[model samples]
Structures are given as C-alpha cells and as structure tokens.
Target chain A: MQNTALLTVENLCVEIPTRRGILKPVDDVSLQIAPGEILGVVGESGAGKSMTGNAVIGLLDPPAHISGGQVLLNGKRVDNLPREQMRRVRGKQIGMVFQDPLTSLNPLLPIGDQLVETIQEHLPVSQREARDRAVAALDEVGIPAASSRIDSYPHEFSGGMRQRVVIALALCAEPDLVIADEPTTALDVSVQAQIISLLKKLCRERGTGVMLVTHDMGVIAEASDRVAVMYAGRLAEIGPVRQVLTDPQHPYTAGLMGSTPGASLGRRRLNQIPGTMPGLNAVPDGCAYHPRCPRAEAKCRAEPRPPVSGSASCWFPGEVKI
Target chain B: MSALVKIAGLTRIFDVSKPWLNRLLERRPKAFLKAVSDVDLQIEERTVYALVGESGSGKSTIGKVVVGLLAPSEGSVEIEGVDLHRETDAAKVDHVRSDIQMIFQSPFASLNPRWKVRDIIAEPVAARGGDTKGLSERLLEQVGLAAGDADKFPHEFSGGQRQRICIARALASNPKLIVCDEPTSALDVSVQAQVLNLMSDLQEDLGLTYLFITHDLTVVQHMADTVGVLYLGRLVEEAPRDALFERARHPYTQMLFEAAPRIDAFGREVDPPKGEIPDPINPPSGCAFHPRCPLAIERCTRERPEMRQLGPARVACHMAEP
Candidate 1:
C-alpha cells in the first residue's frame, strides 16, 4: 500500500516537553494518501488531528517536534529535510489550507500579488505568466469575475469568497498533495458544499492527494475515500469511509458516530460517551480510550492495545453494546 | 401545553454605515442592514424550535431578540402572552425577564476567566438576591459534572466541561426559555452529544423551551421539534422537523438539506449549491434567494413570495409545489 501511495506517514510521533512532564500529542499515527485520493483525519479538539498534519508538513512549532517515525512523499523521506530545503518542498510539492482563511492570507498585499509571488517562487514562471495563471486559478475555484476580484483585498470578499481565494492560493503551485485542515468549517453550509466540491474536483483533475482534517463526520462521508479516527493522540480506527461510517469497529469510533446528532436519525437521545477524552499528560494505561470505552475491561485498563494492525486498535473491536 | 414563547413580525435593522464625516466626504447616505425581517414563529411548551440559516442570514439576531438581549426595531416578543418589551408593569417585565436565559456559542469567551465556577453558575440567582446556597453544586451535578468542580476556575475545565458550566449557569435561574446560539458548535462530537443529551433530559425534567439557533442542519434535525429555514433575514420555510427533512418544500430549504453532508450519503455526488448569499446591506430587489435559486424565474426576481401553506409546511417561494 505504501509503494503506490503519494504520501505515507509511518508511526509518526510529535511531543511537546512541559515543565510538569512531556506530552505526546501525536503517538504512533500511520496513514497514507494515494494519487487522487482523500484520507480524512478526524477527532475531537485535543485528539491531535491537526498536530499530525502539522508534523507531516514540517510546520510543527518549536517545543513540539517530531520525535519519531518518518513522513515520505512519493517514497522519498521529507521529514528530515533541513529548514530551507523543507520550505521549498512545502510550496513546490505540498500545499496547505488552514481553518481560517483570513489568517492564511496577507492583509496588506492584494491577493493577486500573493498568488503571483508564490507561483514565481516555486514554478519558474515569469511575472506576467504567473499573473495570468493566478487569474485562471481564481476563476477555476468559482470566484466570479476573477480578473477584477484578483486585486481585491481579503476583507473585501465575503467569508465564502475569501475561502475560495485561499483554496486558489493553495492550488496555484499545483502541488502533488494538499493538506486541508478544517477547510470549510468556518463557512456556511451552502458555501461549504461549494468548497468541498471544488476541492474534490481540483484534486481529482490534478491527481493531487489530499489529507482533509476535520471534526465533521458529514464532510468525511461526502469527500473522503478513507477515514482515520483518532483518540487521545493515537489512531483508534482507519478504513474505507463507508465501512467506518456504517460499521465502526473501535468503541471510540462507534461512540463518536452515535453521539453526532445527524449521523443517524430517530433516536430520542444521542449515545453519548460517558467521560471526556483524557488529557495528554493523563492518558490512561493500556488503551487511551479505555476510560471512556463502554467495552473496556481489566485487560484494556492494565496494558496498551497493540499497534493498529487491522482496521481498529482494540482488544474487543466491534463488540461495543449499543 | 400552550406556546411558551411567541414572536411576531420581528424585524431588526442595524446601522452599518460609515461615520457621518466619512459619509459626507464619500458622498454617501446612511446605510442599514436588515438583520431580521418580518419573521414569525412560536415554541410550544417543553419543545425545541430551531432557527437555521447561514451566518449573515440573521438567525443569531433572532435569538438575541427573543432572549431580550436585543430589542426588536419592529414587532413584538411575548413569553407566555406577556410582551416583555412593552409591558407597562416593571415587576411583570422583571418576572418575565427572569424566565429567559441565553447560552452563547463560544464557552471560552462567554465565561469569566477570573470567576470560580460556583460564582459563575450562581450569578443569575445571586444577582436577584435569591438563595444561592448549594445551587452551583447541585446544578453542576445535574449537568453531569462533579459537585467539587464548582470551586475550580473555568480554565481548569475542558471545552465540554466549560459548556456544562455554561449550561449550569443557564439553569441557575430555572428559566423556562433558553436561547442556545450554537451551544454545541464549539464542542467535539462526543462532547457535543453529552451536552445535547443533557439539554434534552433537562428540558424533559424541567419543561424548558429552547430557542435553538444553529447553522448545522444535522443538529437542527436532531434537536428541533420544529424547524425554521431562514435566508437573508426572511423565514423561507417552517415545518415540523421530520416533515422538513423528509421532503423540504422551498428551493432554498431543499438546497440546504441537499448541501448538508450526511453519514448515509457516502459517495453521493451533490450538485453544489449555486451562488453565494447576496449581500444583506444591498439585498436583491425581490426574493433574496432568487440569485441562487435553480428554479428562479422572472416572477421570482420581481416579487417577494409570502409564506403560504403547502402540505404541512409554510413555504415562501414562488416555485414551491403544492
């Protein structure tokens, strides 16, 4: 599976050292994305979904560094590249779309200038050629009157339009992989659908591998080919999207689906997991999820489950009582 | 059981104009943004009524108006047939006011960081010179939090726990109507389920009426007894939750339902919703949604549709089928 993958993350770990103790935010996480495929990484706020993405893109902030494992791009290790070299690899071979469009953009520069600068920096294109390509990129993302809107400030565009501009900027370099972390979480539903379709179309047309990180299961069902469910900095389940959504194996995964209001219908009450996810410093022994897992046993609490060798990392996978 | 809350012809217009000097310099007139326009809805006792729309669609504005945080520029809001805004009796108004409470979207920002959880939850009753002894601890336990947590600060709690604190505060006064403006939007799926389930159980126990405002269709479907679909401040469709989800009437409502990502809709290709929401300041001439309506016609663009009955729904669309 890794041989044909465009991006493969093998046992990646990210740790942040605090005064009290060391925090492992991303622990032994592994997944892959093939050309034209989207693999969704979903978890709660502290589940380390974004940390894994940041680690893969070499954007992990200081104090939180990749402590172990390798991130390979097209079978070539990119995790160990130097700062300057990795900077080049980021824009030239990988693109990123963050949760907030406003933060991702430069307030002072017209969008056109930003796009042109990025294209010229990575693609050996002339200024005029880059300008034309910028217009094309904006137009392709469904921005109306792309030529005129290119010069507009980020504030001038509405929330949805700003997100489209962000998507355009991410794709201007035509990277082989795109990591969109909560790309549409900030937009309205109608606009969110537009952005989702646009991302799918653009990636498929370019055969760009996409790692979409979001907490919304609906987005995962709509866009991803495969889905990875994370819990307390560990991979709980990973499989085809349909299989995971319909028959989630891990207790955590099943509880997540059951708790989400709209995942299913006609229930008088949501099947809520009893406890909050354990904090990084206090992650329980054996299984990180055993504290909240309905199927947890003495074995689960005493020792960690083996690394994910199948669809789920659970001693009692698929045995959760509804 | 009668209507616990009734809103009639609610309209709120905000002055979003440039300063007087700037307007004079720019040769412009004062501008107004109609946040909510001629809306009417009622919540039966012990039921949930959800107002759902895009960000600029004025769902939050309506929630604010209903909760008495914002006065309506036109129309009236009544709780149990007593108009709180226009009641001549001060004592009567105060009594009505004490029955309504609001829970905001962001639990972090809404809470006072400096205050302990006990004080935060007891403020509603304490401010009224009512008994607050053991109130915070009891409510905390009721919301599924430890009674001991009342002495801790808000920062010590996780996002879900903070939301539970917010819920405890909202329940402090034993309010009949709680305006939840995206209360669970800031939470993870499992945590959201926990909070939502708690809210449902509380309503059943206390006979609470919830004015639930959110942009999440799935959440609305799961929590709302009745659903109102808004577009550019206008209520486009109002129906029972199951009726609207099973067969949406208005084009915009249908579009919203289609655009929402569904767990059952894996691998389904939804036609992206057409066009962005029009600017609220300078809305289109007639129906606000005509610009994006797939079935829009000349009449739709020229005349605003009025809400009319159509098979268990009130739809405001020229093209809605009977």
Candidate 2:
C-alpha cells in the first residue's frame, strides 16, 4: 500500500512547546493515500486530525513544529524542504481547502483573479490562458455562468457558492494531492451534500489523492475509500471504509460508529463511550483511550501505549463485537 | 395526550434594509428577511419535536420564539393552555414563562468565562428568585460532571464538559420544555455521542419535553419523536420521525435525505443538489424551494404550496403524490 502511495506520512509527530510543557498534538500517526483515493481522517477536536493535515502540508503555525515525521509526495521527501521550497511544493503539488471558504479566499480580489493568479503562479500558462482555465475550472466545479460570475468578489457569492469557488481554486492547478479539512462543515445540510459530491467528482475525475479531515462520519463513509480513526493524537484504526465502519477493530472506532445515529439505525439510545478523550497534558500513561474504552483491562491501563500493529493500535483489537 | 406547546401562524420578520439615509439615497425600498414564516406545530408533553433545516431555514428563529427570547411578528405561542404573548393575565404569563429553558450552540461563547460553573448553573434559578441552594452540585452530577468541579471556572472544562455545564444550567430552572439548538454540533463525534446520550437519559428520567433544533438528520432521527423539515423559514414537511424517514413526500424533504451524508449509504453517488438556496429576502415567486427543487413545475413557480396531508406526512409541494 505504501509503495504506490501518492502521499505517505510515517510516524508523524507534531509538538507545541507550551508554557506548562511540550504538547504533542499529532503523535506517531501514519497513513497513506493512493492516486485517485480519498483517505478520510476522522477524530474529535484535539485528536490532532487537523494538526496532522497542517503538518503534512508544512503549514504548521509557529511554536507548533513537526518534531518527528517523514512526509513523502510521490516518493520524494518534502517534510525537510526549505521554507521557499516548501511554499513551492504547496498549491503547486498539494492543494489545500480549509474549513472556512471566506478565510481561504482573499476578500479584496475577484474570484477570477485569485484563480488566475494561483494558476499562473504554479503552472506555465500565459495571463489569457490562466484566465480561460480559471473560468473552465469554475464551470467544472458546477458554478453557473462561470465567465460572468468569476468577476464577482468572494463576498458576493453565497456560502455554498464560495465553497465551490474554493474547490475550483484548489483544483485549478491540477495538483496531485488535495488536503480538505472540514470543507463542508460550515455550510447547511443540503449544501453539504452538494459540496461533498462536487469534491468527490472532481478528485475521482483527476485521479487526485485526497486527505479529507472531518469529524463527521457520514462524510467519511460517503466519500472516503479508506478511513483513519484518531483518538488522543494516535491512530486508533486504519482500514477500508466499509470494514472499519461495519466491523471496527478498535473500541474507539466502534464507539464512534455507534455514537453516530445513522450507524445505530433502530437503537433507541446512542452507544456512548463513558469518558471524554484526554487533554494533551494528561494523556494516560498506557493506552490514551483506555480511560474511555469499555474493554480496557489491567494491561491496557498499566502497559505502554500499544503501537499500530496490523490495522489498529489496541491491546485487544477486534475483541469487542460492534 | 395533550399538546404542551402549540405554535400557530408563527412568523418573525427582520428589517435587513440598509440605513435610512443609504436606502433613501440609493432609491431602494426597505428590505425584510422573513425568518420564520407561517409555521404551525404542536409538541406533546414528554416528547421530542425536532426542527431540521439548512443554515437559513429559520429553525433557530423558531427555537428563539418558543423560548420567549424573540417575539413573533404574527402568531400566538401557547404553552399548556395559555397564550404567552397575547394573554392578558400577568400571573398566567409568568407561570408559563417558568416552564421554558434553552441550550444554545457553541458552549465556549455561551458560558461566562469569569464565573464559576456553580454560579453559571445557578443563574437561571437565582434570576427567578428561587432558592438555588446546592442546585448546581446536584445538576452537575446528574449531567455526568463531578459535584466538586462546580467551583471551577467555565474555561477549566473542555468543550464537551462545558456543554454538560450548559445542560446542567438549562435543567436548573426545572423547566418542562428544553430548546436545544445544535447542542452537540461543535463537539467531536465521540463527545457528541456522550452529550446526546446524557440528553436522552435526562429526558427519560425527568419526562421532559424537547424542541430540538439541528441541521443534522442523523441527530434528529435519534432524538426526535416528530420531525419538521424547514426550508427558507417555512415548514415544508412535518411527520412522525419514522414515517418521515421512510417516505418523505415533499421534494425538498427527499432532497434533504439524499443530500444528507449517511453512514449506511457508503460510497453512494449523490446527485449534486440542483441549485443553491434562493435568497430568502427575495425568494423565488412561489415555492421558496422551486429553484433548487428537482420536481418543481410551472405551478410551483407561480403559487406557493400550502401544507397538505399526504399518507403519513404533511407535505408542502404541489407535485407530491396524493
């Protein structure tokens, strides 16, 4: 799986030197995405899903640095690249779509100019060719009257439309990898489906490897070829979406699937895991999820945290029948 | 069973027009955003009635009106047997007012950072001049928080814990109906499950009534007894939960179901929703959903459809099968 991977993250760790102590947000996480595959990274806040994405893209904020990891794009190490070189790698090779479309876009510039500039900056295209590609990109992303609407400011478009514009901007360069973090979370329920579908369509058509980071399991199930479930900065489970959703190996993944109302179906009550995911400073000595896992034993509590062996990082993997 | 809350012809309009001078200078008429249009629904005692919609669907506006946070421009909100707004008796109004409480989204913004959790929880009872002795401690334990933690400030707790604090606060008033507006949307999937489980347990134990409002259909399915689908401030469909899910008659309702990313429907190719939600200020001529609705016809564009009884649902669509 790692040999033909378009993007591979190995033993990644992101740390922030806070006043109290050093906080490891993304800890020993590894995952891969093949060309034309969408890898969904699902976890709660502080589970380091977004942090992992940022680290992979070399866009980690100051003070929070990738302390240990190897991020490879198409068999080349990009994690240790120089600042200028990393900037070139971003957008030109790995496109990013963030949670808020408004923030992702420049309020001052017209939508067309933003797309054209991004296109011209990364690709060998003339001004006129870039503008034409921008319009085509917008149209491909299902923007109506793309030529005319391209001139409008980001503020002029609605939230859903703005997201479509963001997708166009991300894919305008025809990058090999796309990193979308909670791309549809800010939109309405109806519009969420539209955006997710648009993203899936565009990525599949271009065979673009995508790392979709979101808390919503519905989205992960709907769009991902494989899923990586994170808990307390560690990868709990990573497998095919169907296998993981149906027969989750890790207790955390099972608990998460049961927590989702759609997964429970006819059950009256949601199967909630007892405790909350621990804070970075207070992650348990053993398994980080041991405090909350129903199947936690003495070994799980006393021993060092289990490493990802086969698919799940748990002492009693697949012991719990979900 | 009798209706505990009855809302009739509920409509709330907001003046969204530019400044008086700006409107005059621009030669433009005043603008109004009809947040909650003519919507009628009844909530039976000890039952959950969920209002589901997209961002601009006016679900939150309806929740505000129910909790007396906002007054309806045209309609009567009756609690038990007395109308809250139009009732002439002060004593009667005050009695009904004591029976309602609300839980808002974004627990971080809702709770006061300076205040201790105890005071935050006790505020509702204290404001009502009721005895708040040990109220916070008891409610805290009930919501799965430690009684001793009540002395800590809101910032000390995590997002899920803060939400539990919010729940404890809502329950402090000993209200009959609790209006929760996307209460768990901010939390992670696992944490969301815990909070939702707590809510469900509390509802069962206290026999409480809930006017649950959210954009997630999965949450609605698990929590609500009756479901009302809203579109652009209008109730497009209302039905019992199972019936609505089984066979949604209205095109809008069906569209929402299709658009909703579901865990069961893994990798299902969803057709991109037709068009963006029309501008609520100047919504399409007839049906507010016609522009985006797949089954919209000529009649739909010419005249607004009233809620008509279908098999087990009340659908507001001209083309719904009778």
Candidate 3:
C-alpha cells in the first residue's frame, strides 16, 4: 500500500446472485497500472474486460457485488468506497471514455459545454475558465479549431472528433488515471488510429496512468506498456506487452494470438481453438480454457492455481522461457 | 479478364431524421444524406474487392444497392454485364440477380431462430431454382460444421457456426458475386478469424468473387485483393492491398493507418487518426475531409478534388501529389 503503483487489484472477485445460484463473471484476478504507464486488459466479448472496468468504477449493474479482494488507487483501498466518495473519485481521480463516443457523449449538448461542465464539476472553476481549459485540453489532443468546434454539438462532429471531445472531457479534470474501455473500437481504422494516438499522447504528457481495455491485439501492442489476457473472466496471462503478445506462455494467450488473422499466415488459416466461449452461467471445473486449449491433458482437469512463472494460470507451464 | 461485377457512379440519397409531424408542420427541407455516393469499381472473376469504412460511410449502403435492397439514384450496378434496374424484362432481372448473392452482418438475426439450420440453408436454393439434394450436409461440412448441426436450432450453435450456416445459405444460390457486409464484425476475434478463413476457402473452392465490406483493417488485410476507402459517401482511395497498405496517399488514409492499433509495433504513443468524417448531407466544401485534414491546403477548402491516379493508387485528395 505504501508503494506508488497508482492502481492495483489483488485477487479481485465479483459475484452475481442469480435465480440459479451465485455466479462469478470475474474470478480471482489481479493486475496493476503504474503511474504514467499504460496497462492493456484484452479479451473477447463476455471475457470480463468491460466488467472489470465497470467494477473498478463502481458502475456495475444490480445483483452484481464485489465479493472478495481489494482494489487500490494511489495505494488507498477503494473496493468499498461509499457512493458519494466513489462518484467524486470517478471524474476527478479516474476518468473514463467508453467505446462509442456518440453514446458516451450527450448528443443534445454542445461538445464544448459538456467538457466545460465536466471540468467545472470537479473543480471550482467558472464557466469561462472551464471553457478555456476545455479548449486547451482539446488542443492538446490535436483537434483542429478547438475554439470553434467546442460550441458544436456531438452530432455536428465526426466519430473521431466526438471521441476526442470525450477524451478532452475525461482529461480536462487532469485525473491521475484514465480508464479507456475500447475507446477506438467504434471508429474507422484510420480514425481509430487517431483516437489511440490522442489517448496515448495525453496520458504521456500529463503522466496519467491508463487502463486501456480492448479486444484488438494490435491496440494492445501499440499502446500498452503491459498486457493482460483475460479468458472466461480470469487473467490467463499478464506480462510485458511484447513478451505476452509475441511469445505467449499461457496456452489461452497463445491461442488468442494464433487466432488473429493478421499475426501469422504460414499456417494458411487461423489456428482455430476447436470451440467457442462457454456460457457465463456454467463455470468450468478446472482450467477454464481447457475446452478450446489444444494442449490440454489430464492435469488440466484439476483446478489449477495461478502460474508463478511471469503471472499466468496454467497446469503445465513448465518454465519461464522469456 | 471478364469482370464479375461493375459499379459506376453509385449513389443513394435517403431523407432520414425527418419526423412525420415535422414534415407536416413546416416545409421540412428534404435532407438528403448520401449513404452511397459516386463510385467506380470492378470485381474481377474469383477475386475479392473490399470496401472499408466506418458506420455511415456508405459501405453497407453500396452492398444493399448491389443486392437490390435499395436502388441507386444516380449510378448503375452491373453483374456480369447485366444491369439490375434496366427498363428491361423480368427474365434479364432474374438472370442478373441469380448470379449475385449477399451475406448479412448478424447471423443470429439473419438465420431464423425457429428454423433448423437445414431449412435456413435450403431457403435460398429453393428461391433460386437450384438443387437442394445433399446441400445441407456438404455445405455444413465445408463450413466446418457437423451434419447434425443442421438439425439444431440457430440458438444451439455458436456465433461462428451460425455464421457458417448463413454462408451455407448464401452458397445455396451459387452466385458468382457475393457482397459480404461486415459479416464477421459481430463475432469474436477468434471466431472472426475462423469465419474469414472459411470464407476464403469457400471462395477458392467455388471460384466466388467477393465484394467484402468491413471497417476492420485486419479483415481487409486477410481477404481483400483490392481495397477501397470510403468517407461520407465517397470513395476516397482505391489501390491494390499491398499498395494501399504501403503507399496510401489520401491524408485521411494516412491518418487512418496511424490511428489503428497494430500488432508488430507496441508501446508507442499514437495520435488520433484524423479529424472526423463530416456529415454527408452538409459535408465540408472542397474536399469532404478538408476540415479534419492535418495537411489541408488552400485548394482543399475551395474545390472538391476528383479521384486521380497517383503512383499505383487512386486517391481523392489535393495533397495526393505531395
């Protein structure tokens, strides 16, 4: 707690008491983001990437509760922060920009107004001062005509611009950490690049540690300092970005990388993992990815603990090669 | 080479967003949003031509028009030299349509929930006056699905399998040209790779020409022989896959490349792709992308640049020569 890791999650677990029984979407998971560094949490849909983000922000829907573990922001326990305290911490200390900029932004309000309101809420700044700060934030993100476009509504702006506005809103308060959950997923490839660049640029300039969650491996490789691969709500692998992506130790992580169309072509086709993600309600008895893992054996049937080698969960991760 | 498909100046204007009450009260201006604007492209026999753009960029609209879902306002659509909407007879229309088929985005929605996979795949064959004997078993196997999968409901199958059933249905018609509109975007990345690989394999076996439409650059990299970039109802750049990837001339294209997170390069700060694509109804004067262009010149503000050949790429940008 005394160390300045910026944010740390230790064996975080959340449960939903459904009609059937207690179900866990995010199992025992632990990760960290250092000050000014970027941590990428990646997985497919229902892999708990968004769930983890939502849990961190206290925005989890009803019936969902943080059952066990601890979350530390700035070395302070934040798992059970009160609603009012959490609300204050949300925009001031840890900002968020969602996947769809259009939905995240209030389409009825002008972009400038939204940013100004966001800035003024956390800080005791007048509308004029907030507007000035908004323009400055927009400019910092490389948006053109920061002065004029500020007055335009979200509909008037393009997808990339709208995302920039969301970024400006998130950063105008100058938070210590920004949780961008699939920030560029909704934009075009070229525009997706711009938003990713802008997010990385601002985080770098302001020394804002970022928790970037996305499904794209390319984004993780390009933007993240560290990478965490989640499977069935658990962290299958976590390491240096290049180490985890290029030479994955965990079979789940390796399968994910192999499944990507652009990664390798000598195999002729994606090395398919035999099956799809299991339904969230049915928890696997042992290694969650055993169904799709190619190298699974009898040992895989026994519930495996988190691998000690470079932070992975596996039954037979013999040695740390990297 | 005999082209399998040809699109010349394809344009479709839709007046959405105007309510009935608003239209009755005041003389509401006919808001024409050019969903698919002027464009020229050719699909060579058995080759895949990919059109890539974000939502509202008219890539899907063009697919819709090609499949006669919507008729183009100002351009012509030809399938093997037969026009879709000529003042011609029904025999010609039937003949033209028989050679063209389309695969939709969501397999869950596209494949009826109540129907078994066998009936779903056989519907197109029944419609197109094709043989249905042993079709389901063969097509299912081709897509890597078991023959027993044909007896199950769509809900029983995974997304990838459901999409395979959709592919089987599309194949039922045995079209020379298939317009695939973001077919894999709704599935997981791993599943997407499987489906894409399957599509490529199917193409190879059937000698099918694919007009693959997607916003994901990775998918384009895997499936496209030629790539076209669209922005606000216009085709901004067209080039061979490698040429487009290596030598994109359009500022928007350049920005797009920079914005997308890539796999090989990790841990670098990226900028926003480019400015947002403007509204097609009231697009920016001169170049549609001028307002957001990082290298916008004076010429970009005054007159719209026509698509011109530069190097091996065809680009619509005043900055192309530079």
Candidate 4:
C-alpha cells in the first residue's frame, strides 16, 4: 500500500523571495496519499496548509517557487515539469476545488459550457459526449435535475448548489487526485455535511486520492483517513486520523485537540497555546512551535527535533497533560 | 435576572426582486425575501445568547438588528428597557447606542486599512465625544496586546491579533453588550481557541453580555449560555446550553447536531443532512424545516408550530415532546 501511494511529497520546500528576506512558507514537508484515501492537512492560516496543496498541484503563483524536494504523482515527478505540461496535468490528472466556488468558476459562462470545455480539454471526447458526461457528473454530485440545472449560470444557483457544481467540475474529467482547499468552509453546516459526504462517496467509488486542506478539525476528523498537522511550515504530526486526534504524540497536535470545543464536553475553558504562529520570515530557530508550546524546554529551542520513527516531530513525543 | 437586551417579534424583509421595468418585461411579480420572521429573544446580563443556524437562517440579520446596524422592518429592539427604534428622546437613544458595540466576522475587512491601530480603537470613543487619549493603549493591553503596538497598522498584525484589536475597539466604548457575528469562523482552531478564551475572560472580568451568532455547534456549545436554533428566519428551538446539546427537541436542531462533525466523535459515520434549506423567498408552508425533517408529520406541512415551552427548552415542532 505504501509503494502504491497515489501522490507523494518528499522533503518539499517552498520559498517566497521578499524585500526583507527569502520566506520559507513550506519547509521540508513530507507526506503521501494512498489511492482512494483522503489525507487531511490541518493547520492555522500561516501554517502553510494551502501552500502545501498549491505546491502539490503546481499552482504556486510567481515570486514563490518550490526551492527543494519533489512532488511525485503516480511515481512521476511532476513538480519540475514544464509550465504547459504542468497545466495539462492539473486538469487531466489532478483536479482542484478552491474555497470560493464563485471565483473558481466563470460567471459569464453557463455551468454546462464550462463542464464541457474542461472535459474536452482534458479528455479526447467529442462535444456531445462531453455534454453527456457533464450532466452525469452533476448528477453524481447530487445535483437534482442535472439536465435542466446544467443550463443555469452560476449566479442562478444558490451558494451550496454552486459549490456542488464546483465539485462536479473538479471531478468531471475523472482525475486521480483532488486537492480541495477549504472547500466546505464557505458552506453552511448542513450543506457542508452534504458536500463532505458527496466528496467521500464520489472519491471512494472512483478510487481517487484526495488532499483535503482545512483548518477545521471536525472536518478533518470526519473526512480524512490520515491526518497531517502542520505548524509554521513544518510537519508537526502525521498519522492515522484516530491516533493523531485521540492520542496526539506532538504537543501541537495535543494542544489543538484539547482546544477544540468539539473534543471537550461541557463548558471547560479550552487549553490554549500561548502566542500566535510566527510568520514565514520570523519562524524561530529549532522548533517553530517552541515559543508557544507548553512542553517546550531548552533542548526544544536549541535544536530542530526530527520526526520520530512513527510520525511526530517533537523533542518529547507522546501526550503531555495540559 | 432582568434582560439586558430584549428582541420582540423582530422581522426584516429584503426587496430582492428584479426592477420594475425588468419585472414588467419578464411578466413576473415583485419578490420580497423574509430574512427574519417574528423572532423573540431575551438576553440576560453577563450571559451569552448564541443564535446558531445555517446561512439564510437570518442569524446574522438578527445580530445586526440587535446591534442597530440594520433596522428591523417590524418589531422592537430594547436595550435596558428603552426601545432603540421607538425611543423618541435623543438622549435616551444616544445612551442606548453607547451601551452596544459589535465585532464583525472578518477582522481584515472590519478594520480600516489606512488607519493606525491607535486611531482605529479611538474612533469609537471619539465618536461619543469621549477623550481618546491613551484609550487605545489601555485597551490594547486589556485585550492581551502590548501598549506600544498601537502605533502599527491593522495589516501589521496576524488574523488572530487583528481580531484582538477589533475586540479592543469594541471594548473602547465600554459597552455593556457586544454582538459578535461569527467572530472566529475565519480563524484557525488554535487561534480560535485563544480568541474564545479571551472573550470568555473578558466576559467574566467586565461583566459583559454577548449576542453571539455562529453556525458552528461546538463553538456555540462552548461559548453560549443559551442557544437558539434558527431555520428559515424562524426560531425553531431555544434552550439552555446543556439542555439543547443533550436533548435537542426540534428535528432541525437534532439534525444540525448530528450533521456537525465532532472531533471527539470518531469512527461514527455521519449521515448527511437530508435535503437543502428551502428557498427563503418561497419557503414551504408550516414548519420551514418540515420538508427536510426526518420526523416531520402531516401537521408539520399544513400548520406552523408555535413556540411552546417544553421542559427546559422552547420548541416549535409538533412532534417534539418534553
């Protein structure tokens, strides 16, 4: 199963050159997603969750580029591929669902046209066949009356429906991997559940790998098979969802679990980690989390802790009582 | 305990229809969206009253109305027994206005980009003709920021810190009630924990009341003393936090609780909430949630359920029992 991983990121480092200095937004991150498995990358805003996702999909904008390591899709290194080739790989092999569906989609075009265009661009299908597949894709994502709804413009549909349409667009070409960055964050709770289940079902049926990037631990707990916790551009913890959430080996992971209201019952005050996450430029020496970590010691600030044999990167691995 | 804030039969309607010429050309009637419908709430002093609902449920609309940002099309809002809309005396209205402050969801959008942190926090105090000298510095310290950091701009701080600044600005007015509309939704879990802890601490130290609005059930559980479940502009259930969480009386409330993914709840397969929230413009007859409610009965389709006391909870569902 490990050898047959669908997507792999090995010691990936992304750097953004600014006037002040070179900001390593993503540093030495490594993870793998098996076929038909969902790997949830959980972190705060500056933790480089989206940056990792963008790096995987070759969507990193200018001034920011992968400085080290490699991204392998189906055993082929795609990170160093040419621009046009990478663009081709995006729609054909790896699909993406961003946070906002409106911005991802073209408002001027109808849903049907967009779907058909993407299908035709990626696959060697005729316009008629692409339209049929487009309708089928919409229906697969639980859009009611897909045949009729396909003609509607984006604004005509509600927020939830537009999101479903976005999902359909992502999966219409039948990509092997889907990187959804906070896909359900913009949705309502009920709709969020629907979209989550829909994504899981569609991916399972198609045997597709998924990289689910979100800050919500609940979503991570619900949708992910394996979870990766990132802190200040580094991997803090990566393991099975159950183990990472229930028995977090890293202090950061433990703090996150303890702080989540969903993880605790009653009105107990959350166990807060002191101070905010350091920016890319100001990320401290040794452990990025040492400044705010409850279990931080002199050793933690003196040397960067390497990942334990299993997954956690911490000076002291195992649960720390809060 | 006497209510610090009273919202009686609050109703807000938005004219979302096409223009007269467009409607005439399209041969369609005018459309009015009933955003909030006959909502009643009594928020006690030093307590948090949370309104939890999906989008279009009018939770934010109610919060806006309570904070006097949006005027209700009908009904009354009373702060300290003075009707904000109906108070004829200028002095009484001013007094009521000064007692209320609001913190918006987006910290980035809420703070002006050009203004320094000092000027931003002092704006509220200055508006009321109060001396702004050293007010921002004091508030920055109170909200867990350095007094000297007031010289910086909003963009200089992280999202969590920006939210802290927003809280400081809200506190600058020395208001008795603060309306927080999805305050931490945009934040990460760890940062969200910090902000939530800060809010809780502030509430205890300052004896402040909060009209908290959010869609996250877990946050509601942690922050709210009393929780109100809204569906299609109607309050379907209102109960003390423990009562609501343990025994959600209304079907919609139950569905929301079940559909929401919980970090503590592992290995449990979440059933996606059935059906979507009905269009607010043409809501279903009777209970708005009846169309999607699993326990909905024939009575639920024809006649709307009135809010009735059921043990510790107030529910508007025919099938719900004490």
* Cα lDDT of model 1 by residue, B1-322, tens digit: 7998888999999999999999999999999999999998888988899999988889999998888889999999999788878989998988988999999999999999999999999999999999999999999999999999988999999898899999999999989999999999988888888889899999999989999999998889889999999999999999999999889989999898889888778877889988888889999988999888889999988899999999999999988986
Model 2: runs farther than 4 Å from truth?
none
Candidate 1 on A1-322: residue-level lDDT in tens?
A: 8689999999999999999999999999988899999999999989999999999999999999999999999999999999999999997899999999999999999999999999999998899999999999999999999999889899998888898888888899999999999999998888899899999999889999999999999999999999999999999999999998889888888888888888658898999889888889998889999888778889998865656867999998888844
Residue pairs in collision within model 2: none
Top candidate, metric TM-score: 1
> In model 3, what lDDT does residue A258 have?
76
Give the CAPRI class of candidate 3: medium
Candidate 2 has an interface RMSD (Å) of 1.1
| Model 1: residue A222 alpha-carbon error in angstroms | 0.9
iRMS, candidate 4, in Å: value is 1.4
Model 4 complex DockQ against the native = 0.70
A best-first ranking of the candidates according to their DockQ comes to 1, 2, 4, 3
> Model 3, A97: alpha-carbon shift in Å?
2.0
Candidate 2 chain A least-lDDT 10 residues: A268-277
Between prediction 1 and prediction 3, the one with superior DockQ is 1
**Per-residue lDDT of B1-322 in model 3, one digit per residue for the tens?**
7888889988888877588788778878657787877888878898999998777789998999888889889989888788878738788888778777889999878988988888888887876677788888888887888887778899988778888888888887778888898899988888987888888898999999999999888778878889999988889999999888876888877776766667888776655443455667788888888888879889989998888988788889877873
lDDT digits (tens) for residues A166-256 of candidate 3: 8888888989999999997776676777677777777777899999999989888998899899988888889899988777888877878
The DockQ assigned to candidate 1 is: 0.86
TM-score per prediction, in order, is 0.98, 0.98, 0.89, 0.96
DockQ-better candidate, 1 vs 4: 1
